[model samples]
Target: MKKRTAAAAMFTVAILATAAYAAHPGADYIKENGYKGPETCEECHPGKAKAFLDTVHWKHASKVTNVDGLDPKKEYGMQNRIYVMCNGNDIVNNLKEIPKNPETGKTKFSGCNTCHPGDHLNDVGSKGAEAEKAIDCLVCHSTAYDFRKRKPMKDDKGRVVMGQDRSKEAALAIGKPTAKNCMVCHEAAGGGVIVKRGFSFTKETDAHAAKGMVCVDCHKAKDHKIPTGTDPNNWANDGVRLSCADVSCHGASPHKDADLNRHTAKVACQTCHIPRTGGAFAKDFTVWAQNPDKFYEPTTLKLEANESSPVYAWYNGTVANTPHFIGPKGSKKDGKSKIYPFKIFQGKAFYNKKTGELLSMDFAPPMANGNTRAGVESAARTLGMKNPEQVAKEAVPGWQTIYFASSHLVTKTRALSCANCHAPNGVLNFKELGYSDKEVVKLTSPELFFNKVAAKMKEDW
Candidate 1:
């Protein structure tokens, strides 16, 4: 029995050794050859090779040649200096000192290729050819875990095994283009260069980070083609459409006029609502509050109603002159001649009095206090009036005598504001209206409810 067990053990050891050899073919090759460079990959994928060369990434790593000499006032000026930002004790601190090759004392260029080593065509060359297409399929798509080196597990056959198949299977199990892939470069922990100002690099920094969302969620395409640009190719690109307002994740639209499907085609959602400065992207609302100049002020109006006095209404200074109400001619039933009270009931009274005489009382106000210009025009047409002035004259007396003020001025008045139509229930927040904010901190603050949106967005992505 002891002799039989020894023979079985010897057979298992032989099987395990053979399995290890098969799984680690590349490992031995890499150690001996030391990265032949991305040129080998280009042999299979040439289209991606050409596209990557045209990007800013390739330009950063391209060695200065006879045709690429420096010019003080030209494209090769101080702007071309590759100085990495040095944050003391920060993730980027390692980058402060110029990158040096351990084998050869040479400074490495600051470019995508630095992190994406698989894109280099010649590992030993001063400048490597762009191999983005090759890298995408090989490096980015592959798992980073060291699978080949892992110990093997035996099968029911009683044979020793290195589990090479299991390692490859495990790598393939992870989803592609996930936030996990993006965080590999975009996060500070992942050797990211983009530093967020006033905000630390944490899971909270990227709302999607916590929800396991990958970078590809928002930036869908592998290429750098933005949908809004003038490039005709962009029209054909099948990337994800991200809207600033009414995204499924936010649970509400931030745009005063949220049109989900159409808005993304017309504008970039992040241009206004997301804060890009200092590496932060739409973390909070404090940034918006501090940078009023970055965004467009929304049209606003305030209406105050009272039983005894003329209803008061005002709009933003630019829109204050728009007429809100009108009265019928000589219909001074309220004992006020030529002057109409800014009340819906008052207008109703004038309408009733004038319509009592005519077979059809077609008198209506030029516009209501909170109505938009287009809305007012539609209402006038519905009431059979040719213009706002005709309705104004017939519906109220002294309608033009009403004072105009900024919507902000009516803070003390008990009235409904323009938000009723423009931003009801926070559905139409002004930030989503393609307005950018310079104050990133304020725009991304918790008080602004940005996290709530981030959380929702992460889930949706």
Candidate 2:
């Protein structure tokens, strides 16, 4: 009888757990009527709408048109014609406008606004009018706006099929923006969570966020441009500037240990801070040599992160330029720069064998194009759909690399130890980083400790 009573209690607990998981009518709420643009929102909350018009998110996701055929900001190897034809030439307007086959008037780019909400069908052009139309405030301010939408599937009955915007329903019932809202783009980036972005940032974890200080606390935007660069106007260098040494947040003398303080100039605050990222699960990266999966539904998710240690590099702001790969700028010798931690995401994109150029794939949204005729024509997919028997087809599989600045997951513990990089078994191959193993070992030897002590002694005077 006691055992039976215990089983009943367990069943009641299971029901409550299911209710929590199915947190509905609150957020990720599907709007049957779809998203209403920023203009309509301005009527109720004029202040937020007027101010949000100037933000970097607005510019990068909405304002800037891919006018320069040569530069797509970040290289994906996919050519403009193939991308434009699939996602449509319209990079201007948000998602209210879905790109149609100018000939057939069928949907083309459906899930383009998964990151930036609004219309994509209408051409915003160089003019700001169309760009202004795409701003959806619930994206940033609403606590419930989880970045989700219906998978672009076609109806077999020849009926006009339409996708969904959960944010529209989410916008109706709203509150102040939380870390959850910011992660709509940050975490769900690069096709999946923990795939890209610095530290796979999440609200529930991270040191500052764990305490209660949210993203906006440090990353305060003035007129929507976040100033992280050496120079304020240079908005490109946004995320590189925050430090514990800064006067506003934490004063210059934050460290109690004078010995550790000397390493400040050479090493970044995050180098010692943010130790491990992702809650319970550590961060990692991988690329497919063959059988690449779809955009969002990547099957190769391993709970363990790729590298136990963050890659050390001299970070200034932007990464060093390359034909394909770009590294954040940091010099071994330059005093202005600091040795920072970086998260490396390794993935695959097709590359031309003869020319040695990295090939590109059209990164369409998750489950966007299935077996539909439009899916075959878009080229947004990789060769995963192709028969395995025809494996070594035309384009030879090549590897790709993405570097993210590892500064977000600011935890008090979990820093890399001396052996993690200096020892022979370390994650970083010294030779790959342009150094001999013995030389780097000697460089990180006891002398670094002694130098810190001496600097502390001098400060005492």
Candidate 3:
């Protein structure tokens, strides 16, 4: 009968293309466990791929060496816009080879491969061997990594082809790396965890990830470096980077008040101990309003959770606050400026109403690259617009705030006491915190400044 109706229409188009390849997001965990990338887990994990290629998360994908420099007239006395570095050019060298945007086919914003997914690495000199998407390391040592339910499917030589043996069943969901493999790109940081990481890393839990600790147990690493302790003289240089006071897990005066341990020489034990975080995700900004012709993809967004509201600034962790916003110096008249505590975020942007400016300079990650949708259409294609929501109603609106310095929650019963900033509807506003209205009437009359400091400590004892 006409060859059995063309063999029943090629067996119903091969069972509807295998039910549209099991609808992605780890596509049946990359087809029942298989992702042999990261070079077959570096052939039996070569010392965890040479200590995860000296991390910053596998060199944040590619090209990095712009250690965010500064000098602003021998230290913050004025103009240099007080240290905010997404890379303020110490050295970014030629570092090219991003290519792809033939009119937004998209790919050129190298703020680290949009968050180190895979298939890059072969620049900065060439002994070239890796890059067939070499560091997928089962998207961080798999907990059966569904790699954000990956729906990629490219091929025709465009690479990324997850069919069949799925890189050998994603190498049987690899071996170790939990904290659910580092919150699958850190709880969608800046684009997920309720839009730029705040309290509760989106839901992966913290307080040392619910008391089990991992993020390589306080970011561990030896000779391959990765310690980034942000200097206490390079935390005694065990290749630098390790502290919560060098992981005694809090004991360099874990505070029982020596006047909050004499404000840690201008504050920074995450400023008055994590006084706030992620609250309904402060000014959510709809996860940075992506849509340069609709591109925001944390595997197809839905995120909106948010929370946090602890803003009290003056950080002095040097210049533009390295690795983005160091909450330790708001120089309330700079005696090495202390008075810290900030988590602030308040949003609202899009400017340039015929030369009002401020459309994107502040977006900075070569134009806003937190986790990358081509760094949000390369800061809306470097603000030429092309239709970032048709230039948002002929644009012109401001307010940014940002200031993270949000060190994770530690909780000595939610800290922040001493009348939550010497109350009077507190949280600091002493003439918008420059103080001196006689120090805002002795910090808003705290019971007559503690009854004149308890009658001048009973007339100096």
Candidate 4:
């Protein structure tokens, strides 16, 4: 009795599942019409159908017009002029038919329409039309179209009107179009086929692709209007404005001025943000090799200082590994002393041993005249330092401040030292450490702490 009950329950569940699937209109449509082709859709959407006939996809699917100075029927032994590699049953032998140009009298096999199917056919079923016009939205968008359930108009007596239901069957009906469906043809050797204006037939295989993001997600109709170029006016639809810094898929902004979020006005996001074969590129900005692990955060920083005191600063970061800095230097006390030693002036200044001059200093106000307040006024002036300071604060907000005591004291010389700015971990941790990492890696000896730190940064950081 128990076994019989279990079998009955399983049978009931199967029937319910079948009924649920049958309810979906798409499934019913596919059942009735396998794939009738674009002609069925033309009956309803004539305008769209007309536009589709002008595309390249329709031309590829059509029968060969001429062959070898003769008709396709005379040239090829096949009954039909178009000899497609049929996946269906009835594999006819030697059915391959070569296409020819009627005007040039030259024989051609297959063209662009072989892959882009939309451009091969015409609305009127004519062969003279250009192939590019066949790329109809229905070929890709109409996943299913059912005419069986379509109801006829009702009369005043609530009876179905005769000849009112003019529902036509669809062609190539099946599952809905998805990102996976697009990839079938768009993908090429190792990656998606990139086309004019930075468009790709397939989605990128970077981290975003791995996460299952589709091409249409970011490159929506609105976003596609912007073409890749220096001149913004050339862009279609007056250009698409998007925040490259805010794209969640890419994670973070790669620009120094990313925090300002002012990129939308000057250039489209794809101009600098899109992935290229070599790397990312911008007009006058530096480019980086393809890096899949780059990360960014939207943040800001504030710097304040006094004449004798170090500058205080803070940041609000989203992720870990945020960078920080400390004091600067003035004059050297000993002959063999390192310019920016950890201790010495309690981490206040980094001195130069040769000329007994300060190499770097922490953030401090310039010495003010007696008329102005000494510490307070000088601190205010230092706080207002623009350009590099403002740029840095915007790039990485709340980042620790390493103030150079006085601009006049140090020689404004920039050194490529790992320990200087990066310290124990240093910029070596960066996937691409610019030229500074390469230079530092070569100069230091193997046993030196700086060398170990650089190696460790490369390994751990």
Counting clashing residue pairs in each candidate, in order, gives 33, 17, 33, 48
Which portions of model 1 miss their true places by more than 4 Å? Answer: 1-46, 61-79, 82-113, 119-138, 145-175, 189-205, 209-212, 222-461
lDDT of each: 0.29, 0.46, 0.45, 0.28
Name the 10 consecutive residues with the lowest summed lDDT in model 4: 279-288
Residue lDDT tens for model 3, 1-461: 99999999999888866664543334454354454455544444465554555444444322212123433223211011212112111112122233443445555332222344444333211122453334455666556554544433445866443222234545554544666676666665444454444555322334565566666666665533445543211111223545565635675666775766665665567655566665322332213444564333222122232245566666544423332233333467767665555555444434446665434322332222233333333445544568654444455544444455455655555566556667777766767767777878776777744765577679989
Candidate 1 vs. truth: CA RMSD? 27.1
| Model 1: how far residue 188 lies from native, Å | 3.0
**Candidates ranked by lDDT, best first?**
2, 3, 1, 4
Estimate the lDDT of model 3. Answer: 0.45
Q: Candidate 2 — which residues are off by over 4 angstroms?
A: 1-37, 40-54, 61-112, 122-134, 144-176, 198-204, 227-244, 277-307, 353-355, 363-396, 416-461
Question: Tens digit of lDDT per residue, candidate 4, span 1-461?
Answer: 99999999999999977874754334455446643334444434455444443322322122222112223332121111211111010111111122232333343221112233332222222333342233333334433433232223334764332111122333333223455445444432111132111223322324344456544454343211321111111111212333324454333544454422343332223322221222011110011122222211111111111112212111111111112222322222222211221110111111222232212111111111111112222222333533423232222112122222111111112222334334434422222322355655553324435565676689986
Q: Give the residue spans of candidate 4 off by over 4 A.
A: 1-24, 39-108, 113-116, 119-176, 188-204, 221-461
lDDT of 4: 0.28
> Which is the better candidate, 2 or 3, if ranked by lDDT?
2
> Per-residue lDDT of 5-112 in model 1, one digit per residue for the tens?
999999999897666556444444444444333343344335655555433333322222112123323322111221111101111111111323333344322212
The residue-level lDDT of candidate 1 at 226 comes to 21
Measured with C-alpha atoms, the lDDT of residue 349 in candidate 2 is: 39
Better candidate number, 3 or 4, judged by lDDT: 3
Error of 1 at 63 (Å): 16
